[model samples]
Target: DVKVTQSSRYLVKRTGEKVFLECVQDMDHENMFWYRQDPGLGLRLIYFSYDVKMKEKGDIPEGYSVSREKKERFSLILESASTNQTSMYLCASSLLGLWATEQYFGPGTRLTVT
Candidate 1:
């Protein structure tokens, strides 16, 4: 089975603090993504990389960025954490061009900005 690992299970930060979240996948999926899951908003994409060193901004890219230096690793960086940014961040990966490509998600990192 494919595995995706997140760096933190929970995090607490002050408003305006810079934060970094890491993700690693065992499967060599071509598509990688970072999303913030909010109560009502659901999973809103932050960024995704289709290939190593190549990235594209997703729907909700504000306040966040991503890095894909290797096929197995992807990182999400929050330039400045905010109170409204308190949410569960999920990392996912999928195989490109698969008709029913379902994203495999990590356990998620719940961040609370105070």
Candidate 2:
């Protein structure tokens, strides 16, 4: 079975502290994505990598960055945590080159920056 695992299910941090969220997929997928979900804005893509070491900035990348060192692992870094950045962060992985391929999502990490 294909599985995606997240390092944390919840996180609490003070403003200005750096945070790291990790994800790993058991499936050998080529596309990995990081997204943040807000109440009004919905799910907004933060970053993605189609291949190892090749990352693309997404819609909201101002305070976020991503690293994909291996095919199955992707990491999201919050440069400096802030109250506005508090949201549920989701990580997903999908197979490449398939029109209908569904992305396998990890249980989101709910981060609260006070």
Model 2: lDDT equals: 0.94
What's each prediction's clash count?
0, 0
Model 2 per-residue lDDT tens digits across residues 1-114: 889999999999999999999999998999999999999888999999999999999998999888899999999999899999989999999999969478889999999999
Name the candidate that leads on TM-score. 2
Q: What is the C-alpha lDDT of each candidate?
A: 0.93, 0.94
lDDT at residue 40 of model 1 (Cα atoms): 81
Q: Write the per-residue lDDT of candidate 1 for residues 1-114, one digit (tens) a residue.
A: 989999999999999898999999999999999999998888999999999999999998988888889998999998888898899999999988859479999999999999
| lDDT comparing candidate 1 with the true structure | 0.93
List pairs with backbone clashes in candidate 2: none
